[model samples]
Target: MNQPGEDFYCDEALSGRTPVTVVAETADVLAFEHTRPFWPVHVVVVPKRHVPSLTDLGEADEALLGRVLAVVRQVAADVEREHGACRVLTNLGRYQDSKHLHFHVCSGAPRHPDTD
Candidate 1:
């Protein structure tokens, strides 16, 4: 079973079918508030173009990868500046429920919501 907001970014956000609380965006990257945030300051950063995982990045994706990381860096800075500290991470292999390449920028305590 697909957990409520699991893979929500690919299933909805990227498709533009579901409105997201966007925090930042560039031509190739998007950083937005998690639809169902598990952490107090959870934000998702992704490339507008689908790339499966960080390990899957190829030479052809060099420019796109740079753009994605740039957005990730900025989002993390903003979060840390306000929240004191932040964690920037990406899930891989079995830990990655969503196949799309994305970075999680989070801080503070988790909200502990039932939906997540």
Candidate 2:
């Protein structure tokens, strides 16, 4: 059964929405676009399992956690190549909305003077 914040990443899924780039995926994760991105190359890294919070992770989740980071690195590298450069970040406590453990990979700023 899904937990309270497990559906944090589900907003886009449930809404049947799509983002600009869905770079990669694994057995336990999905990488997609950030709806309200803070950077030029913004992507969201989500786990396939509906895990409600990073603080709530258990023994079984340890491996999944590691895999998430691994994917983040790979994706970040790709983002740099494709978009030049980017940032990888994760929110905690009040910073997180979905309560689900996710990573935000971004490249460049929301408004770069060079772009404008």
Candidate 3:
């Protein structure tokens, strides 16, 4: 679990600020749709607490981590049902921007042909 002194993004996605539709949520995790989707269907799953990064997760957060993964699986199943297929993604260190641990569930192919 995250405590004070940690700096991370708020649960803004839960409010549907992003392109997410909020599939489910728990004490520690949240699942939602992606606004500018990488694929036809894109969703982002995140931990509610403010963990600076995946590398910053503490011992007490082990269960929370497990729950996050479980939600990923459940959300992935839901995404597949809705979009036919899906991809699970997580970033580390420099690749992460929000500074909070989150997973992106992507489905279908890139919308723009110019994208690589």
lDDT of each: 0.85, 0.74, 0.73
lDDT by residue for model 1 over 36-63, one digit each (tens)? 7889899999988667789986333788
Per-residue accuracy of model 2 over 84-113 as CA lDDT, tens digit each? 878888777777777677888888868665
Which order, best to worst by lDDT?
Answer: 1, 2, 3
For model 2 the local lDDT of residue 25 reads: 85
lDDT of 3 by residue, 66-113 (tens): 899999999999888988888898888768766678888888877884
User: Candidate 2 at 28: error in angstroms?
Assistant: 1.0
Predict model 2's lDDT versus the native.
0.74
TM-score of 3: 0.75
On the 0 to 100 scale, the lDDT of residue 76 in model 2 is 91
- Quote the lDDT for 71 in model 2: 89
Sort the predicted structures by TM-score, highest score first: 1, 2, 3
RMSD of each: 3.8, 4.0, 4.4
Taking all chains together, each candidate's TM-score versus the true structure is 0.86, 0.75, 0.75
Candidate 1 residues lying further than 4 Å off, grouped into runs, are 1-7, 58-60, 114-116
